[model samples]
Target: MLRNVATVIWDGVAPFEFGVVCEAFGLDRSDDGVPLLEFGICAPQPGLVRTSLGFGIEVVDGLGRLEEADLVCVPAMRRGDPLPDGVTEALWRAHDRGARLLTVCSGAFALGEAGLLDGRECTTHWKYTDQLSARFPEAKVVPEVLYVDSGQIITSAGTAAGLDACLHIWRQEYGAAVASAVARRMVVPPQRDGGQAQFISRPVPEIDAETLGPLLAWISAHLHEELDVDSLARQVLMSPRTFARRFRAETGATPYAWITAQRVRRAEEMLERTERPVEWIAGEVGFGNAAALRHHFTRVRGLSPQAYRRRFACGESAESA
Candidate 1:
Protein backbone atom coordinates (compact mmCIF):
# COMPACT_ATOMS: atom_id res chain seq x y z
CA MET A 1 0.00 0.00 0.00
CA LEU A 2 3.01 2.31 0.22
CA ARG A 3 2.94 3.97 -3.16
CA ASN A 4 4.04 7.54 -2.63
CA VAL A 5 7.37 8.48 -0.99
CA ALA A 6 9.18 11.73 -0.22
CA THR A 7 12.46 12.58 1.49
CA VAL A 8 13.00 15.93 3.16
CA ILE A 9 16.49 17.36 3.26
CA TRP A 10 18.20 20.19 5.04
CA ASP A 11 21.53 21.94 4.75
CA GLY A 12 24.44 19.57 5.50
CA VAL A 13 22.71 16.34 4.55
CA ALA A 14 24.82 13.18 4.24
CA PRO A 15 24.80 12.06 0.62
CA PHE A 16 25.04 8.32 1.24
CA GLU A 17 22.20 8.23 3.73
CA PHE A 18 20.01 10.30 1.41
CA GLY A 19 20.91 8.00 -1.45
CA VAL A 20 19.73 5.00 0.56
CA VAL A 21 16.17 6.29 0.43
CA CYS A 22 16.49 7.23 -3.22
CA GLU A 23 17.82 3.83 -4.22
CA ALA A 24 15.15 2.00 -2.27
CA PHE A 25 12.13 4.07 -3.25
CA GLY A 26 13.14 6.55 -5.93
CA LEU A 27 14.46 4.09 -8.48
CA ASP A 28 12.12 2.76 -11.18
CA ARG A 29 11.90 -1.01 -10.78
CA SER A 30 8.72 -1.47 -12.79
CA ASP A 31 10.59 -3.60 -15.32
CA ASP A 32 11.19 -6.12 -12.54
CA GLY A 33 7.49 -6.16 -11.53
CA VAL A 34 8.15 -3.96 -8.51
CA PRO A 35 5.58 -1.23 -8.11
CA LEU A 36 6.77 2.22 -9.09
CA LEU A 37 6.39 4.79 -6.34
CA GLU A 38 5.74 8.45 -6.80
CA PHE A 39 8.97 9.66 -5.25
CA GLY A 40 10.19 13.22 -4.71
CA ILE A 41 12.80 15.13 -2.75
CA CYS A 42 11.66 18.09 -0.73
CA ALA A 43 13.19 20.86 1.35
CA PRO A 44 12.03 23.85 3.33
CA GLN A 45 12.50 25.91 0.20
CA PRO A 46 12.88 24.74 -3.38
CA GLY A 47 16.54 25.34 -4.24
CA LEU A 48 20.05 23.99 -3.86
CA VAL A 49 20.71 22.36 -0.50
CA ARG A 50 24.26 22.01 0.78
CA THR A 51 25.54 18.54 1.64
CA SER A 52 27.83 17.55 4.48
CA LEU A 53 30.48 16.50 1.94
CA GLY A 54 30.88 19.97 0.34
CA PHE A 55 28.50 19.21 -2.52
CA GLY A 56 24.99 20.45 -3.21
CA ILE A 57 21.74 18.89 -4.55
CA GLU A 58 19.03 20.79 -6.27
CA VAL A 59 15.69 20.02 -4.59
CA VAL A 60 12.76 21.32 -6.60
CA ASP A 61 9.91 20.38 -4.27
CA GLY A 62 8.99 22.11 -1.05
CA LEU A 63 7.52 20.77 2.21
CA GLY A 64 4.09 20.69 0.61
CA ARG A 65 5.08 17.56 -1.26
CA LEU A 66 5.08 15.59 1.97
CA GLU A 67 1.35 16.11 2.17
CA GLU A 68 0.74 13.55 -0.54
CA ALA A 69 3.46 11.08 0.39
CA ASP A 70 2.55 7.70 1.85
CA LEU A 71 6.01 7.56 3.44
CA VAL A 72 8.30 10.42 4.44
CA CYS A 73 12.03 9.90 4.84
CA VAL A 74 14.68 11.85 6.71
CA PRO A 75 18.36 11.17 6.13
CA ALA A 76 21.44 11.91 8.21
CA MET A 77 22.33 15.55 8.69
CA ARG A 78 25.17 17.31 10.49
CA ARG A 79 24.66 17.01 14.24
CA GLY A 80 24.58 20.69 15.06
CA ASP A 81 22.85 22.04 11.98
CA PRO A 82 19.59 23.78 12.77
CA LEU A 83 16.40 22.05 11.57
CA PRO A 84 14.89 24.14 8.81
CA ASP A 85 11.90 26.30 9.73
CA GLY A 86 8.60 24.37 9.49
CA VAL A 87 10.38 21.00 9.27
CA THR A 88 8.92 19.74 12.55
CA GLU A 89 5.47 21.06 11.68
CA ALA A 90 5.60 19.31 8.35
CA LEU A 91 6.53 16.07 10.06
CA TRP A 92 3.66 16.52 12.48
CA ARG A 93 1.26 17.05 9.61
CA ALA A 94 2.49 13.94 7.82
CA HIS A 95 2.10 11.90 10.99
CA ASP A 96 -1.36 13.30 11.70
CA ARG A 97 -2.43 12.23 8.22
CA GLY A 98 -1.21 8.66 8.93
CA ALA A 99 1.86 8.70 6.73
CA ARG A 100 4.73 6.59 8.03
CA LEU A 101 7.92 8.46 8.90
CA LEU A 102 11.39 6.94 8.62
CA THR A 103 14.77 8.18 9.74
CA VAL A 104 18.27 7.07 8.80
CA CYS A 105 21.24 7.60 11.12
CA SER A 106 21.18 11.02 12.81
CA GLY A 107 18.01 11.87 10.94
CA ALA A 108 16.26 10.56 14.06
CA PHE A 109 17.28 13.81 15.67
CA ALA A 110 14.80 15.67 13.49
CA LEU A 111 12.02 13.35 14.65
CA GLY A 112 13.21 13.89 18.21
CA GLU A 113 13.04 17.62 17.59
CA ALA A 114 9.52 17.26 16.27
CA GLY A 115 8.52 15.27 19.41
CA LEU A 116 7.44 12.40 17.13
CA LEU A 117 9.76 9.93 18.85
CA ASP A 118 8.34 10.54 22.31
CA GLY A 119 6.89 7.36 23.82
CA ARG A 120 8.06 5.44 20.75
CA GLU A 121 10.87 2.95 20.40
CA CYS A 122 13.48 4.22 17.91
CA THR A 123 17.13 3.96 16.94
CA THR A 124 19.84 5.78 15.01
CA HIS A 125 23.48 5.19 14.14
CA TRP A 126 25.27 3.52 17.06
CA LYS A 127 27.63 6.49 17.30
CA TYR A 128 24.67 8.72 18.07
CA THR A 129 22.36 6.37 20.03
CA ASP A 130 23.53 7.70 23.38
CA GLN A 131 23.06 11.26 22.26
CA LEU A 132 19.61 10.45 20.84
CA SER A 133 18.66 8.89 24.15
CA ALA A 134 20.07 11.76 26.20
CA ARG A 135 18.43 14.41 24.06
CA PHE A 136 15.06 12.69 23.95
CA PRO A 137 14.54 11.03 27.30
CA GLU A 138 11.07 9.74 26.45
CA ALA A 139 12.16 7.90 23.32
CA LYS A 140 13.24 4.31 23.88
CA VAL A 141 16.52 4.01 21.99
CA VAL A 142 17.51 0.50 20.97
CA PRO A 143 21.22 0.82 20.19
CA GLU A 144 22.25 -2.69 19.20
CA VAL A 145 19.86 -3.51 16.35
CA LEU A 146 20.00 -2.58 12.66
CA TYR A 147 16.64 -0.77 12.79
CA VAL A 148 13.47 -0.32 14.84
CA ASP A 149 9.99 -0.26 13.31
CA SER A 150 7.57 1.15 15.87
CA GLY A 151 4.26 1.23 14.01
CA GLN A 152 4.07 4.65 12.36
CA ILE A 153 7.78 5.42 12.66
CA ILE A 154 10.88 3.54 11.54
CA THR A 155 14.44 4.40 12.56
CA SER A 156 17.51 2.64 11.25
CA ALA A 157 21.14 2.38 12.28
CA GLY A 158 24.08 3.71 10.32
CA THR A 159 24.62 3.51 6.54
CA ALA A 160 23.73 0.17 4.95
CA ALA A 161 21.17 -0.61 7.62
CA GLY A 162 18.96 1.94 5.91
CA LEU A 163 18.72 -0.34 2.93
CA ASP A 164 17.82 -3.22 5.22
CA ALA A 165 14.97 -1.22 6.65
CA CYS A 166 13.77 -0.22 3.21
CA LEU A 167 13.78 -3.85 2.11
CA HIS A 168 11.76 -4.75 5.17
CA ILE A 169 9.13 -2.22 4.19
CA TRP A 170 9.07 -3.61 0.68
CA ARG A 171 8.62 -7.13 1.96
CA GLN A 172 5.76 -5.97 4.15
CA GLU A 173 4.03 -4.01 1.43
CA TYR A 174 4.59 -6.25 -1.57
CA GLY A 175 5.45 -9.70 -0.20
CA ALA A 176 8.74 -11.59 -0.22
CA ALA A 177 8.68 -12.42 -3.94
CA VAL A 178 8.58 -8.76 -4.90
CA ALA A 179 11.05 -7.75 -2.20
CA SER A 180 13.48 -10.44 -3.29
CA ALA A 181 13.26 -9.21 -6.87
CA VAL A 182 14.16 -5.69 -5.75
CA ALA A 183 17.02 -7.02 -3.67
CA ARG A 184 18.31 -9.04 -6.63
CA ARG A 185 18.55 -5.88 -8.67
CA MET A 186 20.33 -4.13 -5.81
CA VAL A 187 22.76 -7.06 -5.31
CA VAL A 188 22.14 -7.34 -1.56
CA PRO A 189 20.69 -10.01 0.60
CA PRO A 190 16.93 -10.15 0.20
CA GLN A 191 16.35 -9.94 3.90
CA ARG A 192 18.32 -8.99 7.00
CA ASP A 193 16.38 -9.02 10.23
CA GLY A 194 16.24 -5.76 12.09
CA GLY A 195 17.10 -7.66 15.29
CA GLN A 196 20.50 -8.56 13.90
CA ALA A 197 23.32 -6.80 15.75
CA GLN A 198 24.29 -3.34 14.61
CA PHE A 199 27.85 -4.25 15.56
CA ILE A 200 28.89 -7.89 15.25
CA SER A 201 32.09 -9.23 16.80
CA ARG A 202 35.08 -7.12 15.88
CA PRO A 203 37.76 -8.74 13.74
CA VAL A 204 40.28 -10.64 15.85
CA PRO A 205 43.93 -9.97 15.24
CA GLU A 206 45.29 -12.45 12.69
CA ILE A 207 48.82 -12.99 14.01
CA ASP A 208 48.87 -12.11 17.66
CA ALA A 209 51.21 -14.39 19.60
CA GLU A 210 50.45 -13.05 23.06
CA THR A 211 46.63 -12.94 23.24
CA LEU A 212 43.44 -14.96 22.73
CA GLY A 213 43.61 -14.12 19.04
CA PRO A 214 45.05 -17.51 18.11
CA LEU A 215 42.42 -19.32 20.18
CA LEU A 216 39.64 -17.34 18.50
CA ALA A 217 40.88 -18.33 15.05
CA TRP A 218 41.17 -21.94 16.13
CA ILE A 219 37.58 -21.89 17.40
CA SER A 220 36.34 -20.67 14.01
CA ALA A 221 38.17 -23.45 12.17
CA HIS A 222 37.14 -26.10 14.69
CA LEU A 223 33.49 -25.11 14.87
CA HIS A 224 32.51 -28.77 14.50
CA GLU A 225 34.01 -29.57 17.90
CA GLU A 226 31.98 -29.51 21.09
CA LEU A 227 33.29 -26.15 22.31
CA ASP A 228 32.68 -25.44 25.96
CA VAL A 229 34.01 -22.81 28.34
CA ASP A 230 36.16 -25.26 30.27
CA SER A 231 37.74 -26.73 27.11
CA LEU A 232 38.37 -23.33 25.60
CA ALA A 233 39.83 -22.17 28.93
CA ARG A 234 42.14 -25.16 28.99
CA GLN A 235 43.22 -24.49 25.40
CA VAL A 236 44.25 -20.97 26.42
CA LEU A 237 45.79 -22.19 29.72
CA MET A 238 43.43 -20.05 31.79
CA SER A 239 40.84 -21.01 34.39
CA PRO A 240 37.27 -21.14 33.14
CA ARG A 241 36.22 -18.11 35.21
CA THR A 242 39.13 -16.02 34.03
CA PHE A 243 38.70 -17.09 30.41
CA ALA A 244 35.01 -16.28 30.44
CA ARG A 245 35.63 -12.81 31.85
CA ARG A 246 38.45 -12.04 29.43
CA PHE A 247 36.52 -13.32 26.43
CA ARG A 248 33.57 -11.07 27.28
CA ALA A 249 35.88 -8.12 27.75
CA GLU A 250 37.68 -8.65 24.46
CA THR A 251 34.83 -9.83 22.23
CA GLY A 252 31.93 -7.94 23.86
CA ALA A 253 30.01 -11.25 23.95
CA THR A 254 30.01 -14.28 26.19
CA PRO A 255 31.87 -17.34 24.96
CA TYR A 256 28.63 -19.16 24.24
CA ALA A 257 27.09 -16.24 22.34
CA TRP A 258 30.24 -15.70 20.29
CA ILE A 259 30.58 -19.35 19.33
CA THR A 260 26.89 -19.62 18.51
CA ALA A 261 27.03 -16.57 16.27
CA GLN A 262 30.04 -17.94 14.42
CA ARG A 263 28.32 -21.27 13.92
CA VAL A 264 25.29 -19.53 12.40
CA ARG A 265 27.55 -17.58 10.06
CA ARG A 266 29.26 -20.80 8.95
CA ALA A 267 25.91 -22.46 8.40
CA GLU A 268 24.95 -19.51 6.20
CA GLU A 269 27.98 -20.08 3.98
CA MET A 270 27.22 -23.77 3.67
CA LEU A 271 23.63 -23.00 2.80
CA GLU A 272 24.67 -20.51 0.16
CA ARG A 273 27.43 -22.57 -1.45
CA THR A 274 26.43 -26.23 -1.03
CA GLU A 275 23.35 -28.41 -1.34
CA ARG A 276 23.98 -29.86 2.11
CA PRO A 277 21.06 -31.14 4.12
CA VAL A 278 20.10 -29.24 7.26
CA GLU A 279 20.88 -32.13 9.63
CA TRP A 280 24.34 -32.61 8.22
CA ILE A 281 25.09 -28.89 8.29
CA ALA A 282 23.89 -28.63 11.88
CA GLY A 283 26.31 -31.34 12.97
CA GLU A 284 29.17 -29.88 10.95
CA VAL A 285 28.61 -26.49 12.57
CA GLY A 286 28.43 -28.07 16.09
CA PHE A 287 24.70 -27.58 16.48
CA GLY A 288 24.36 -31.38 16.98
CA ASN A 289 20.92 -31.48 15.31
CA ALA A 290 18.71 -29.68 12.82
CA ALA A 291 16.32 -28.46 15.54
CA ALA A 292 19.03 -26.51 17.33
CA LEU A 293 20.25 -25.14 14.03
CA ARG A 294 16.80 -23.92 13.09
CA HIS A 295 16.28 -22.30 16.49
CA HIS A 296 19.55 -20.37 16.46
CA PHE A 297 19.48 -19.55 12.77
CA THR A 298 15.95 -18.21 13.04
CA ARG A 299 16.84 -16.18 16.11
CA VAL A 300 20.03 -14.74 14.64
CA ARG A 301 19.17 -14.39 10.95
CA GLY A 302 15.36 -14.23 11.21
CA LEU A 303 14.85 -17.10 8.78
CA SER A 304 14.77 -20.86 8.91
CA PRO A 305 17.76 -22.75 7.49
CA GLN A 306 15.64 -24.26 4.72
CA ALA A 307 14.21 -20.84 3.84
CA TYR A 308 17.67 -19.29 3.81
CA ARG A 309 18.96 -22.03 1.56
CA ARG A 310 16.03 -21.62 -0.74
CA ARG A 311 16.67 -17.92 -1.10
CA PHE A 312 20.47 -18.00 -1.31
CA ALA A 313 21.60 -21.45 -2.47
CA CYS A 314 24.10 -21.67 -5.32
CA GLY A 315 24.04 -17.88 -5.59
CA GLU A 316 20.71 -18.03 -7.42
CA SER A 317 17.30 -16.63 -6.60
CA ALA A 318 14.80 -19.19 -5.38
CA GLU A 319 12.00 -17.47 -7.28
CA SER A 320 13.92 -17.31 -10.51
CA ALA A 321 15.20 -20.84 -10.19
Candidate 2:
Protein backbone atom coordinates (compact mmCIF):
# COMPACT_ATOMS: atom_id res chain seq x y z
CA MET A 1 0.00 0.00 0.00
CA LEU A 2 3.03 2.32 0.26
CA ARG A 3 3.08 3.52 -3.31
CA ASN A 4 3.44 7.27 -3.27
CA VAL A 5 6.45 8.86 -1.55
CA ALA A 6 7.42 12.49 -1.07
CA THR A 7 10.82 13.45 0.28
CA VAL A 8 11.09 16.97 1.68
CA ILE A 9 14.47 18.68 1.47
CA TRP A 10 15.70 22.05 2.65
CA ASP A 11 18.84 24.12 2.93
CA GLY A 12 21.62 22.18 4.66
CA VAL A 13 20.12 18.70 3.99
CA ALA A 14 22.83 16.07 3.82
CA PRO A 15 23.13 14.76 0.27
CA PHE A 16 23.95 11.21 1.31
CA GLU A 17 20.91 10.93 3.56
CA PHE A 18 18.71 12.47 0.88
CA GLY A 19 20.12 9.97 -1.63
CA VAL A 20 19.16 7.14 0.75
CA VAL A 21 15.50 7.94 0.30
CA CYS A 22 15.85 8.28 -3.47
CA GLU A 23 17.76 5.00 -3.76
CA ALA A 24 15.25 3.10 -1.66
CA PHE A 25 12.06 4.35 -3.30
CA GLY A 26 12.82 6.65 -6.20
CA LEU A 27 14.38 4.16 -8.61
CA ASP A 28 12.31 1.99 -10.91
CA ARG A 29 12.57 -1.76 -10.23
CA SER A 30 9.39 -3.27 -11.62
CA ASP A 31 11.32 -5.83 -13.67
CA ASP A 32 12.38 -7.44 -10.38
CA GLY A 33 8.74 -7.61 -9.28
CA VAL A 34 9.31 -4.78 -6.83
CA PRO A 35 6.57 -2.19 -7.00
CA LEU A 36 7.52 1.11 -8.59
CA LEU A 37 6.82 4.16 -6.48
CA GLU A 38 5.57 7.58 -7.45
CA PHE A 39 8.39 9.50 -5.81
CA GLY A 40 9.18 13.20 -5.79
CA ILE A 41 11.57 15.65 -4.16
CA CYS A 42 10.11 18.78 -2.66
CA ALA A 43 11.38 21.87 -0.94
CA PRO A 44 9.82 24.91 0.74
CA GLN A 45 9.91 26.45 -2.71
CA PRO A 46 10.35 25.08 -6.24
CA GLY A 47 13.99 25.98 -6.73
CA LEU A 48 17.57 25.10 -5.89
CA VAL A 49 18.04 23.75 -2.36
CA ARG A 50 21.51 24.13 -0.93
CA THR A 51 23.10 21.04 0.61
CA SER A 52 25.14 20.72 3.74
CA LEU A 53 28.19 20.38 1.60
CA GLY A 54 29.08 23.15 -0.89
CA PHE A 55 26.58 22.35 -3.66
CA GLY A 56 22.89 22.74 -4.47
CA ILE A 57 20.17 20.53 -6.01
CA GLU A 58 17.30 21.92 -8.04
CA VAL A 59 13.95 20.80 -6.68
CA VAL A 60 10.97 20.79 -9.00
CA ASP A 61 8.03 20.88 -6.62
CA GLY A 62 7.04 22.59 -3.39
CA LEU A 63 5.54 21.29 -0.12
CA GLY A 64 2.15 21.02 -1.82
CA ARG A 65 3.40 17.84 -3.49
CA LEU A 66 3.27 16.08 -0.10
CA GLU A 67 -0.52 16.35 0.00
CA GLU A 68 -1.23 12.97 -1.62
CA ALA A 69 1.83 11.03 -0.52
CA ASP A 70 1.54 7.63 1.16
CA LEU A 71 4.93 8.08 2.81
CA VAL A 72 6.83 11.28 3.68
CA CYS A 73 10.59 11.22 4.18
CA VAL A 74 12.84 13.78 5.86
CA PRO A 75 16.52 13.19 5.44
CA ALA A 76 19.30 14.48 7.71
CA MET A 77 19.57 18.26 7.96
CA ARG A 78 21.34 20.77 10.16
CA ARG A 79 19.72 20.69 13.62
CA GLY A 80 19.89 24.45 14.23
CA ASP A 81 18.22 25.67 11.01
CA PRO A 82 14.75 27.14 11.42
CA LEU A 83 11.86 25.15 9.97
CA PRO A 84 10.48 26.85 6.89
CA ASP A 85 6.95 28.21 6.93
CA GLY A 86 4.23 25.49 6.75
CA VAL A 87 6.78 22.66 7.08
CA THR A 88 5.52 21.35 10.45
CA GLU A 89 1.91 22.10 9.57
CA ALA A 90 2.20 20.13 6.32
CA LEU A 91 3.77 17.23 8.19
CA TRP A 92 0.98 17.27 10.75
CA ARG A 93 -1.62 17.23 8.02
CA ALA A 94 0.12 14.32 6.30
CA HIS A 95 0.27 12.28 9.51
CA ASP A 96 -3.30 13.14 10.39
CA ARG A 97 -4.43 11.79 7.03
CA GLY A 98 -2.65 8.43 7.79
CA ALA A 99 0.57 8.91 5.80
CA ARG A 100 3.59 7.33 7.46
CA LEU A 101 6.41 9.74 8.38
CA LEU A 102 10.06 8.69 8.27
CA THR A 103 13.22 10.53 9.23
CA VAL A 104 16.92 9.75 8.78
CA CYS A 105 19.35 10.75 11.53
CA SER A 106 19.07 14.37 12.71
CA GLY A 107 15.98 14.88 10.56
CA ALA A 108 14.01 13.75 13.63
CA PHE A 109 14.58 17.24 15.02
CA ALA A 110 12.04 18.57 12.58
CA LEU A 111 9.43 16.19 14.02
CA GLY A 112 10.44 17.28 17.50
CA GLU A 113 9.92 20.91 16.45
CA ALA A 114 6.48 19.89 15.16
CA GLY A 115 5.67 18.32 18.57
CA LEU A 116 4.96 14.99 16.81
CA LEU A 117 7.60 13.18 18.87
CA ASP A 118 6.22 14.36 22.21
CA GLY A 119 5.42 11.30 24.36
CA ARG A 120 6.54 9.02 21.49
CA GLU A 121 9.64 6.82 21.61
CA CYS A 122 12.14 7.90 18.90
CA THR A 123 15.84 8.08 18.18
CA THR A 124 18.53 9.52 15.89
CA HIS A 125 22.24 8.98 15.32
CA TRP A 126 23.84 7.99 18.63
CA LYS A 127 25.96 11.14 18.53
CA TYR A 128 22.73 13.15 18.56
CA THR A 129 20.40 10.99 20.72
CA ASP A 130 21.42 12.82 23.87
CA GLN A 131 20.88 16.17 22.19
CA LEU A 132 17.60 14.99 20.67
CA SER A 133 16.34 13.94 24.10
CA ALA A 134 17.72 17.04 25.81
CA ARG A 135 15.99 19.30 23.29
CA PHE A 136 12.69 17.40 23.35
CA PRO A 137 12.45 16.06 26.90
CA GLU A 138 8.99 14.63 26.31
CA ALA A 139 10.23 12.26 23.60
CA LYS A 140 11.57 8.91 24.77
CA VAL A 141 14.91 8.34 23.03
CA VAL A 142 16.34 4.85 22.66
CA PRO A 143 19.99 5.05 21.62
CA GLU A 144 21.12 1.45 21.18
CA VAL A 145 19.02 0.06 18.35
CA LEU A 146 19.58 0.68 14.62
CA TYR A 147 16.12 2.17 14.28
CA VAL A 148 12.94 2.54 16.33
CA ASP A 149 9.49 2.00 14.84
CA SER A 150 6.89 3.69 17.01
CA GLY A 151 3.77 3.21 14.89
CA GLN A 152 3.60 5.68 11.98
CA ILE A 153 6.91 7.40 12.64
CA ILE A 154 10.16 5.49 11.92
CA THR A 155 13.51 7.08 12.79
CA SER A 156 16.79 5.51 11.75
CA ALA A 157 20.34 5.94 12.95
CA GLY A 158 23.23 7.47 10.99
CA THR A 159 24.12 6.71 7.35
CA ALA A 160 23.16 3.21 6.17
CA ALA A 161 20.60 2.51 8.87
CA GLY A 162 18.22 4.43 6.63
CA LEU A 163 18.49 1.59 4.10
CA ASP A 164 17.64 -0.90 6.82
CA ALA A 165 14.54 1.08 7.75
CA CYS A 166 13.50 1.32 4.09
CA LEU A 167 13.94 -2.43 3.59
CA HIS A 168 11.99 -2.98 6.79
CA ILE A 169 9.11 -1.00 5.32
CA TRP A 170 9.38 -3.02 2.10
CA ARG A 171 9.29 -6.29 4.04
CA GLN A 172 6.26 -5.15 5.96
CA GLU A 173 4.32 -3.99 2.92
CA TYR A 174 5.21 -6.70 0.38
CA GLY A 175 7.16 -9.67 1.72
CA ALA A 176 10.70 -10.72 2.62
CA ALA A 177 11.27 -12.04 -0.89
CA VAL A 178 10.91 -8.56 -2.37
CA ALA A 179 12.97 -6.98 0.36
CA SER A 180 15.76 -9.50 -0.12
CA ALA A 181 15.71 -8.97 -3.88
CA VAL A 182 15.94 -5.23 -3.40
CA ALA A 183 18.77 -5.68 -0.91
CA ARG A 184 20.58 -7.90 -3.40
CA ARG A 185 20.29 -5.18 -6.00
CA MET A 186 21.67 -2.68 -3.52
CA VAL A 187 24.46 -5.11 -2.50
CA VAL A 188 23.81 -4.93 1.24
CA PRO A 189 22.61 -7.47 3.77
CA PRO A 190 18.95 -8.39 3.62
CA GLN A 191 18.76 -7.92 7.36
CA ARG A 192 21.22 -7.36 10.18
CA ASP A 193 20.94 -8.18 13.88
CA GLY A 194 22.70 -6.43 16.78
CA GLY A 195 22.42 -2.73 17.58
CA GLN A 196 24.34 0.34 16.38
CA ALA A 197 26.26 0.30 19.66
CA GLN A 198 28.77 -1.94 17.90
CA PHE A 199 29.47 0.93 15.47
CA ILE A 200 30.25 3.58 18.09
CA SER A 201 33.73 5.02 17.94
CA ARG A 202 36.33 2.85 19.62
CA PRO A 203 40.12 2.72 19.71
CA VAL A 204 40.94 -0.56 17.98
CA PRO A 205 44.49 -1.94 17.94
CA GLU A 206 46.15 -2.30 14.54
CA ILE A 207 45.01 -5.61 13.02
CA ASP A 208 45.46 -7.58 9.80
CA ALA A 209 44.46 -10.94 8.27
CA GLU A 210 47.21 -12.46 10.41
CA THR A 211 45.05 -11.58 13.36
CA LEU A 212 41.29 -12.42 13.59
CA GLY A 213 40.15 -11.98 9.99
CA PRO A 214 41.01 -15.49 8.80
CA LEU A 215 39.67 -16.89 12.05
CA LEU A 216 36.33 -15.25 11.33
CA ALA A 217 36.15 -16.92 7.92
CA TRP A 218 36.97 -20.23 9.55
CA ILE A 219 34.23 -19.75 12.12
CA SER A 220 31.70 -19.09 9.36
CA ALA A 221 32.65 -22.30 7.64
CA HIS A 222 32.45 -24.35 10.82
CA LEU A 223 29.45 -22.80 12.53
CA HIS A 224 27.98 -26.17 13.57
CA GLU A 225 31.04 -26.87 15.77
CA GLU A 226 31.31 -25.65 19.33
CA LEU A 227 32.99 -22.22 19.12
CA ASP A 228 33.86 -20.99 22.58
CA VAL A 229 36.62 -18.57 23.55
CA ASP A 230 38.79 -21.42 24.87
CA SER A 231 38.41 -23.49 21.67
CA LEU A 232 38.99 -20.48 19.40
CA ALA A 233 42.06 -19.46 21.42
CA ARG A 234 43.69 -22.83 20.84
CA GLN A 235 43.09 -22.56 17.07
CA VAL A 236 44.87 -19.18 16.96
CA LEU A 237 47.75 -20.21 19.28
CA MET A 238 46.78 -17.71 22.00
CA SER A 239 45.44 -18.07 25.50
CA PRO A 240 41.77 -17.42 26.16
CA ARG A 241 42.28 -13.95 27.63
CA THR A 242 44.53 -12.68 24.81
CA PHE A 243 42.29 -14.19 22.13
CA ALA A 244 39.18 -12.61 23.66
CA ARG A 245 40.78 -9.18 23.77
CA ARG A 246 42.08 -9.46 20.21
CA PHE A 247 38.73 -10.67 18.96
CA ARG A 248 36.84 -7.77 20.47
CA ALA A 249 39.44 -5.28 19.28
CA GLU A 250 39.33 -6.57 15.72
CA THR A 251 35.59 -7.27 15.29
CA GLY A 252 33.94 -5.01 17.84
CA ALA A 253 32.02 -8.03 19.16
CA THR A 254 32.71 -10.80 21.60
CA PRO A 255 33.30 -14.23 20.09
CA TYR A 256 30.03 -15.55 21.45
CA ALA A 257 27.94 -12.62 20.18
CA TRP A 258 29.50 -12.55 16.70
CA ILE A 259 29.29 -16.32 16.30
CA THR A 260 25.67 -16.41 17.40
CA ALA A 261 24.78 -13.59 14.98
CA GLN A 262 26.44 -15.44 12.10
CA ARG A 263 24.64 -18.66 12.99
CA VAL A 264 21.35 -16.80 12.91
CA ARG A 265 22.22 -15.34 9.51
CA ARG A 266 22.99 -18.80 8.21
CA ALA A 267 19.76 -20.13 9.63
CA GLU A 268 17.87 -17.34 7.89
CA GLU A 269 19.44 -18.27 4.54
CA MET A 270 18.60 -21.94 5.01
CA LEU A 271 15.03 -21.14 5.98
CA GLU A 272 14.58 -19.12 2.79
CA ARG A 273 16.68 -21.16 0.33
CA THR A 274 15.60 -24.67 1.32
CA GLU A 275 12.29 -26.12 2.45
CA ARG A 276 14.16 -27.67 5.39
CA PRO A 277 12.39 -28.26 8.68
CA VAL A 278 13.17 -25.99 11.63
CA GLU A 279 14.80 -28.80 13.63
CA TRP A 280 17.24 -29.57 10.84
CA ILE A 281 18.12 -25.87 10.45
CA ALA A 282 18.57 -25.62 14.21
CA GLY A 283 21.14 -28.40 14.20
CA GLU A 284 22.96 -27.04 11.15
CA VAL A 285 23.22 -23.55 12.63
CA GLY A 286 24.52 -24.76 16.04
CA PHE A 287 21.29 -24.06 17.90
CA GLY A 288 21.04 -27.87 18.43
CA ASN A 289 17.25 -28.05 18.72
CA ALA A 290 14.09 -26.52 17.33
CA ALA A 291 13.18 -25.05 20.72
CA ALA A 292 16.53 -23.29 21.01
CA LEU A 293 16.37 -22.02 17.45
CA ARG A 294 12.85 -20.74 17.99
CA HIS A 295 13.90 -18.84 21.10
CA HIS A 296 16.97 -17.16 19.57
CA PHE A 297 15.39 -16.56 16.19
CA THR A 298 12.32 -15.00 17.74
CA ARG A 299 14.44 -12.86 20.01
CA VAL A 300 16.63 -11.58 17.14
CA ARG A 301 14.06 -11.31 14.35
CA GLY A 302 10.88 -10.45 16.24
CA LEU A 303 9.17 -13.50 14.74
CA SER A 304 9.17 -17.28 15.14
CA PRO A 305 10.99 -19.55 12.67
CA GLN A 306 7.77 -20.87 11.18
CA ALA A 307 6.40 -17.37 10.87
CA TYR A 308 9.61 -16.09 9.26
CA ARG A 309 9.60 -18.88 6.69
CA ARG A 310 5.95 -18.27 6.04
CA ARG A 311 6.64 -14.62 5.42
CA PHE A 312 9.87 -14.98 3.40
CA ALA A 313 10.13 -18.34 1.60
CA CYS A 314 9.76 -18.27 -2.19
CA GLY A 315 7.52 -20.10 -4.73
CA GLU A 316 7.17 -23.86 -4.16
CA SER A 317 9.53 -23.62 -1.23
CA ALA A 318 7.08 -21.23 0.38
CA GLU A 319 4.04 -23.45 -0.21
CA SER A 320 5.91 -26.52 1.07
CA ALA A 321 7.10 -24.75 4.19
Scored by TM-score, the top model is 2
lDDT by residue for model 1 (1-321), tens: 899999999899999999999999999999998899999999998899999998899999999999999999999988666688999899999999999999999999989988999999999998899999999999999987889989889999989899999988886566565777789999997766676667645345346424677898999999999999999999888999988877866665779988897898788777766777888899999999999999998886667888777765655543211
> Model 1: clashing residue pairs?
none
Q: Rate the local accuracy (lDDT) of all candidates.
A: 0.86, 0.84
Model 2 poorest 10 in a row by lDDT: 193-202
In the predicted model 2, the residue pairs found to clash are none
Clashes of each: 0, 0
Candidate 2: TM-score? 0.83
Global lDDT of model 1: 0.86
lDDT of model 2 at position 241: 99
TM-scores of the models, in the order given:
0.68, 0.83
Q: How large is the C-alpha RMSD of every model relative to the true structure?
A: 6.3, 3.2
Model 2 lDDT tens row, 43-88? 9887999999969999999999999899999999999878999899
